[model samples]
Target: MLGYGGTSSPDDPTLEAFKYQKMLADRNVILSSCGIEIESGEKAHLVGHDFSAIFSSTIVFYYPQVALTCTLMSAPHSPPGRKMDLDVMEEITERELGFEFTAYRPFLLRDDSWQLIDAHKESLLQSCRGLTRNGSRTSCLRDA
Candidate 1:
């Protein structure tokens, strides 16, 4: 949450809060600050997509009390298998798909990517609302 937009600046203290194991407590602090009160037996429900899913599961693993329910979108929960960084995954992806993912391009590195994100926002909302391409509701949502 520290690195996420509008949160604390990316300084040493914030960086420390973002550490994997420490994030559970930090999340509680943030929630408390926001006037959220999770009852003793209540678990936080987490929703995540793509890379965020990793953080969601890891948080659940480190502190089951913090959260146990997760709804992951598009990308499934990919539990860590081995030590493979983005570079390694990029190579493997190129080999399999004959193309590079957008993260590699300095093209989408900063605010330059905002337009793309905005363009997809509506479709993303539709998928979340379980709407089909015809603007009809469906049991399962899929982008057209």
Candidate 2:
């Protein structure tokens, strides 16, 4: 599970989809929606995939420092060991450049500054997409 956060705006799945496609090119990470839209007499409702609902809730309580980095959470399916966890993160991170995966110490940005976080995230995503587009098979557990 890879998590992200932004104060710029609420979660926009459509916009996020484009960004995700541009960033996470690994075929494993599949982002989709399973909600409904209802329009009533004088009101409307738009519901989609709530990433928080599925994302690990312990991020805030367990890894507070992650709140500042471009990365919010990264939960990998390894053999229940620190080394395996590092291996998985490294493999996925290798798809993109400039990502130093150190458990929860992702330093994609400086000091939780939201100014460049989105751009950084997009750049990384674009690079990840390029890897797959260039015919390399770097697999993530979340791949489609």
lDDT of each: 0.59, 0.36
**Using TM-score as the measure, which candidate wins?**
1
Give the TM-score of each candidate.
0.56, 0.24
Task: For residues 49-105, write the lDDT of model 2, one tens digit per residue.
Answer: 334322222332333332332222233322212344556766677657434334223
Which one wins on lDDT?
1
Model 1 residue 45 lDDT?
A: 79
> How high is the lDDT of residue 112 in model 1?
55
Window of ten residues with lowest summed lDDT in model 2: 37-46
Candidate 2: global Cα-lDDT? 0.36
| Per-residue lDDT of candidate 1, residues 64-94 (tens digit) | 7766577776555555555646667667766
